[model samples]
Target: MSQDYDKILKENIEALILPLADKLLGLSLGRLEEIPDDIQTTLERRPDFLKRVISSNSHESYILHLEFQVKDKAAMLNRMLLYYAMLKEKYGESIKQYVVFMGRRKPRMSTQLKEGMIDYRFSLVDIHQLDYRKLLDDATQPEQAVLAILSNFKKSEVDTILPEILRKLQALTNNERKLRRYVRQLEILSNLRDLQKETIKHTEAMPITYNIEDDIRYQQGIKYRKRQRRKYRGNY
Candidate 1:
């Protein structure tokens, strides 16, 4: 990743919006599979560029075009319209279009008003609007739990609420369970808790490869997965 503002923004989108797409749009992508082919370089420039183009066979074997916007800007709907038109022109109308906004605050979106236009408009997901605490309360509902962690929540909060959060997260869809286990494994792999001041002081003398961002995200994914697994195991 480029050591620039775009890199930070892209990382946040990878950790935040991509998961939302899976939960809300029924689309899934690998950890580093988000680099869009059509407009990869443009996105790194923080320009209002396109995200990715992919094909899937989940329901009817269609293409997935995804965009991750960190903040709101002028003429967003117009840009959305342009993206839709461009993708359809390039890949035919059969490809599905999905644009998600994980901005800190929700923006007012104008209704699609183009005449004779039949296209899938963007879907907005405001990170600030998501309630991680409420999702933790609904751990029996793994989907919401997954949504909660995947949404934007402070790291400090995750630490304090982990146990209870884990308790509620144990119930999710079967596929969600499998994904949860994968997340748990990442948490162990990241060993993020070792970043604590106490731990850091002791480990400062040694070489550490743990990245706080990776560990937190790994824990979040694991929590979502573990909750589903627990639900499947009937431990709820």
Candidate 2:
């Protein structure tokens, strides 16, 4: 169950990066570039999303490192410092780092490290603190609409927003295949905010189409079974 939840969380966060980078980073980005994910520290620690974005104003480019967290972890600040050191070593550019907490509870994680001669810090944001209406108002991007469910939406607004979000997602897609994928993503993200029932209720009325095989979780299950079969056959 934990694994399934983590998978959904990862997919939801990744899907929104393209559409919500500016909002997430609080900067108007000109051109967004994905950095290679294989960069590792000497100790073999891999960091999360590392991006190169050009500032909308000034036209200057910088590195944006983002780490998404569902719960507070011990020594997270140390980990971020390690990642920052490794990233600075490789890119040789100014790197701005941020940690986005997706959990419903208030974040208690440390965002800075202050000791003798070493002062390091990074920005921390909680998704629930953000205003949901901003995302709901963005009609051009379906990703924002989907993410708005996890934001600070009032309980009274759920009925109205959920249906509208589903309608917008369906209209954004051109074919049944794409529509299903979006719906599946919406379902997964809604679960994070404990609105799975509302999501199902709204999506059922829409003409969204999806295949079991097209879903990533289903595909992963198939791969896991294949690996298990291969191992059993070898033992036989």
**Candidate No. with top lDDT:** 2
TM-score of 2: 0.78
* Clash pairs for candidate 2: none
Predict model 1's lDDT versus the native.
0.46
Write the residue-wise lDDT of candidate 2 on 1-236 in tens digits. 34554555465655567545566557665777888756663645455567888876776888988877777775779888988887788888889898878776788988889999999999888887766767666646555666777788776788988887777777666788767766777777676677878887787677655566876557879999999999999999
Q: Write the per-residue lDDT of candidate 1 for residues 57-132, one digit (tens) a residue.
A: 3433334555555546656677666656655666563555544554445666652555575634566555444456
Clashes of each: 6, 0
lDDT of 1 at 74: 54
